[model samples]
Target: MKSKGPPGGGLVYSTESGRMCPGCRQPVAACVCARQPARPAGDGVARVSRTTAGRGGKVVTLVRGLPLDDAALAALGKQLRTACGSGGTVRDGSIEIQGDHLERVMAWLQAQGHAVRRVGG
Candidate 1:
């Protein structure tokens, strides 16, 4: 089939942007179909847990099922990290704070009016 042009340029690569989006023929940053993950309406509860499964012997506190949009979730993650005096990242709609600050996180979430449920011991 003859592919459309201009908006649907379908260029595999772009000189100006280095890499262009196939769907919108624009730079990835400006593309209409931004590669954001499908937003999940989580299972109706904010869950907190601690795990040391993958990080050698270091512990990390994980918070999942937050019902915030990307921007808000990132901002909330920053706030939580700051509050916990630790470092963290927001990934796949969840926050991972470095260290086992589960109690502190639950308190902070409750202060922020979220119904937090502790998942693991």
Candidate 2:
């Protein structure tokens, strides 16, 4: 059987339903869809802390429990780095900014509607 083109000029194939599950956009069998309830703003608390575990005792502002995916986390990290005028990265579901900018980070997170707390010294 010949395949048909999708609505937007993409190719669509036969023998396939060409329909996607709204939740995951995957075929039904492979779909691991879950309805993500909307979390209230400022519900999750972002904790900031300092760590000196492997970087020559340099202080880092660690932001955790952001409830963001990897890509969003990366973007947030970039924004925080820019705001703090420092370098940072997102790893292990947390954002790590160079230096001890806990207060600044907390303020920023609060501005973004996230409850924040300082965890460690």
Question: Distance (Å) between predicted and true CA of 46, model 2?
Answer: 0.7
**lDDT (CA) for every model shown?**
0.88, 0.78
Tens digit of per-residue lDDT, candidate 1, span 10-96: 576767777777776678778888766587878757899999998899999999998888899999999999999999899888999
Across 1-115, the per-residue lDDT of candidate 2 in tens digits comes to 5545444343233258655555555665555675445533334778889898898989888888777777888998999999999998887788999998888888988898877
Q: Which regions in candidate 2 have their CA more than 4 angstroms from the true location?
A: 1-43
Q: Model 2 — which ten-residue stretch has the worst lDDT?
A: 5-14
Highest lDDT model number: 1
User: Which candidate has the highest TM-score of all?
Assistant: 1
Cα displacement (angstroms), candidate 2, residue 85, comes to 0.3
Clashing pairs in 1: none
